[model samples]
Target: MAKIEPGNGLKSAESRKSLRGTTESLALTDGEGNLFGSDSELNVYTSERQTDKYGFIGGAQQYSEQSAENIPPEVLRQREAKWLDMLNNWDKWMAKRHKKMKLRCQKGIPPSLRGRAWLYLSGGKVKREQHKGKFEELDSQAGDPKWVDVIERDLHRQFPFHEMFVARGGHGQQDLYRVLKAYTLHRPEEGYCQAQAPIAAVLLMHMPAEDAFWGLVQICEKYLPGYYSAGLEAIQLDGEILFTLLKRVSPLAHRHLKKHKLDPILYMTEWFMCAFSRTLPWVSVLRVWDMFLCEGVKIIFRVGLVLLKCMLGSQDKLKTCQGQYETMELLKTIDTRYMQEGFLVREILELPVSERDIEKEHLASVRRWKETRGELHCKSLPRMHGAKAIMAAEPPSRQDLRQNPTIIVESPLATKSNGEDKERKNTKEQKNGKKNSSPTPVAAYLEPSEPSPLLKDAALLGSNQSLSSAEYDTYL
Candidate 1:
């Protein structure tokens, strides 16, 4: 793992071998990091060029991308001003007018404010402050040998077309490494998940490393717990819940899937696990994430439902999807028409599924799983949906804090300086010839400490993480 490139270890080798012929041909870089050579039409490269504003190497020119007409300048200015005001009075709005906040999220957070807005919406802002310097510490330490190599292999694979990850070990890739490596250190119990790479890569594109690290943390631990864990238990559970919800969302699609014996995980894993980063177009991905950060997993459910319904809901549409292979093929090649950001968001908003509906289905899914497969080993209860409710949930208990203590290795030089200061103080006392009492010798300074002050007394940013539990009963 000394170098960040395609991994060569046993597992990575096995993985590459398994998918070698199935995937598009891969390309390599010369010693100077220029395009070595490639025969695949999909493999396009040039000698170190710049990326467009959206980060794509060739921009949208190759794709003939068509976007809706831009908003009038006056409208754009009004929207920006409104967003600024909301940011200024964020807490007040969340506490009282969160519905308006949700509406704004659906409309689209301004690109300039998107990163900060994401930090606030995902609770990463609060979590980052609560665990100040933790990312640096985790990144500073060497990762588990097993995870390091796996992570290294996947670094260039994420967003390879984007300029951020185009080079083998550019600053973007280095920061991506730091973020992913920090996660493996932060939660060795969970280790690394390949799916996390694209997710983290997208985050790094929008924010700095530390903020991106915390944003990744909040998504893993709070927004979508167990989705990226060792066994993927939560994602599996959600798959069942999604299938069940499909009956209500689009009975025709549900019946088609049932008849074909297609499992939800089959078509949904890449979409759900990576939050559609891989499946959706870049613009749609951003729009969906905007709603996702504001509304939580329910938004995920809505997007999935919309895709399923639009793809397979009608009798006429189902004509082409005659069998298992054809159906899966259609899902793989989703039309860009179904993916326009404005259209998709509007469909998602109009979808009848509510958060309560999702919760009820979740409970029912758990019951079904218990009846058949025995009990699940989900670590924590599902977190509350959306930003306002998350901000309103009770903070973790003191024991939870203790479990996540930060380990700070003291610098040898600093320790020596402290010892010298103590010695000087003792010498002064002895020279005074008054008491000659020696203070208790200091123990080793290398020890674990609390992550943060816990912010029990202070406001978490402008919002409150200490809102009464009664107000947020859904949170656990």
Candidate 2:
């Protein structure tokens, strides 16, 4: 993992000197005559300047070495061809061959095509078209001063080894700043969250500043609304839903976690919020993003289940952990070999769970949440600038909000008033007049349906299977 030097391929010293002079001229120097703005300003330089300074040569070489390795040239050409065809007639492809599109995504999108593919899948292109110059407008406007310092602190830490973001005032870091700052302005109530920095940085890797900004908007407002907000109520509710799913699908692991008092938020917050960017390997992270954009938030739950099955499915494996700290540590740094993107994704597709199942549980979880925490107060916006505008224009019904089937459904519980028919269940433990011995009544949620019959006999059975010899030998 050697650091790629700033100007590796420049053969002549004079040419390198000329490039350096151009970069220095384009850069905004500080009062002390230092190149680029002060750390607090998050000054952005031209991508041309960054390309010269950081040696981000074009095409596959621009990607990380690990990402570029082992990809075949023919495969690259084929993927690019498909991307071109889809881009030219997107509506036709989407309407006629959406299943084929999903299958291709599951195989993994080519790095070169990933940016365009993401825009198409997440509808960022349409968003970008709607708000033609919104990013530039937002970039020029002053963002909330409070968020500037926080955004600056996270810039360098995002992808220090990647050539695009390695330099102090590189294009990648600058675009990341613009996208985040625009988002803070777009939804002032949400402000800035540290989790969003990594997600935005990843987006900047694949697209230009404006495209990246719109993609970030789609992710925040559509893919996972209220996820990066101050209260983080949506993610909190999802954590509870994940726990509920675990109880039915992997009772033994669920009980073990309950016994040790391990909360899902402790480990799952990063996984769900960052979309596994910080947790999974680089290749796996890209693969997950491909499916995630096409399928929406359910991919997240499926991936979480796969990781849990790999880490905690076996009783013997759980027995080795001494305490909550040890279990958390193991989960955080689990063997990546077992969690290879292709195999884990296949397992996810095979799982019996569906969007319908997740929606039902989400509705049930929200009901329980209301009972215990009073009412949820989610912020609402008049209209999001891009892909989320459709959702913002027409307020969703109570059932639609609770179901939250697609990315179009932002702020599931965004409205102020709960319907008159909705009733909060009594969640308090019933007193049996025994000394703390009465069993608490768990919320009455439906039992998870049996997994696909093929999965029932497989080694990995819906997050609760005995460790196979191969898995144990490789991962344990």
Candidate 3:
């Protein structure tokens, strides 16, 4: 993947750049002087701040790739071998041998297989095929002016010190722009969210612009819907759910948070919203995302619980965090040990938070909030979560994916057209059957009800694209 000239890539693959009127700081002008894009995977560049392969700056005690590096080479080889086997038989593993897949995900998807594995786990490949050339079409079209400016300004800020983004308008940033702009075009209503950038950047690191774009769609729509939308109603609900689950995981941390009146959102907004791409160490971040893409949002809640437990779980640890401010400061400067892959993954597995627990908690939180703050700000309820819901809600057949569903937004407060009214009746009937079905105590909260897709597939979607069998087996 040769890096094209900074502005050249944008002009060819994305929109032309203009000097923005806003005075927002650009990461392109970092003190090391501008770096030209290169063909090398690791474009070594001198930096005033400490630079590692994963590109954590500012002398953070922990390096981004430290966790994977610490793994014994023999062990890595074994994991890679297992991943290769699993990748070759993905559908079989996903359906019949899910435990084997989960065990491997818990162990951590080998870095070499990360992107390809993610495409499969996230069902992004299916989405890309469904949409076809939609990305290219969106890329060529001029984006919404409002989103374009903000996206450009934020582009330089995303992993700016990293080799890929060091240039002013390099291929890295150019690709990032294409993904974000394509997203805005894909779902004009959800628009762009600031947290989506780094998440996109991380995906772009592993895959191409189109795959990355589809990966972002899965994260925003299937895995964590309503999270990146207007008002963040879904995250607010999850925040309450996290707090509720926290009580069982770490009572000390839970009690302290409640006593200090610390809203989970205050500390967790960045963590959960960014999917911990911004918080955890790079290797740990990748591990978390691997499991997250595999299992859905449960990985997120478990990660949050693990962090709170480590940071404030003990009386001794809470000595400094007696108040909200102190606890926040500690959260901001999390101990490196907590971010290590070995410790974090182990903790996540040990914690008993399940999809059922989350759904039950989600329903409770929604009802309680409806009474207090009124209904969700958005016109719809929160989506069903976890991997099962994602697969169920998203059609299994490529035929279904190709056929874009007619999306009719419904709200008690909003009026509906006659056609949309008919659609609403159909939707209600679906709800009455499976949507309102009673949940058993164990699997009850899967939010098994069909969720309105936050990012709808449109008529102007992509052209058919297929993943090569060999490429699917190995990212290399």
How much is 417 displaced in model 3, in angstroms? 62
Residue range 1-476, candidate 2, lDDT tens digits: 01112322122344322211122222433223555444344323333333421133222123344332356889877876786566555665665777787788887876656776787677666677666678888999988878876777677766554556657777778778888889898878778877788888877777667778888887887778777765566776788888888776677778777777776766677799888876775667778899888777778888887777777888887877758777777887776555665577778787677667777888897899789878887753321222223333433333332211111111223211222113121222224333434433322222111112232222321232232211221112
213-297, model 1: which lDDT tens digit per residue?
9889888887788877655668768888899999998999999988887777667877887898877768788788999999988
Which segments of model 3 are wrong by more than 4 Å? 1-69, 379-388, 395-474
RMSD of each: 12.4, 24.6, 17.6
For residue 394, give model 2's deviation from the true position in Å: 10
Clashes of 2: 0
Error of 1 at 369 (Å): 0.7
Better of 1 and 2 by TM-score: 1
Root-mean-square deviation of Cα positions for candidate 2 versus the true structure, in angstroms: 24.6
TM-score of each: 0.74, 0.66, 0.73
Candidate 3 least-lDDT 10 residues: 440-449
Global lDDT of each candidate: 0.71, 0.63, 0.70
* Residues 64-150, model 3: lDDT tens digits: 555544778899889987876775655556668887787788778876677777877887877887778888899899999998988
Clashing pairs in 1: none
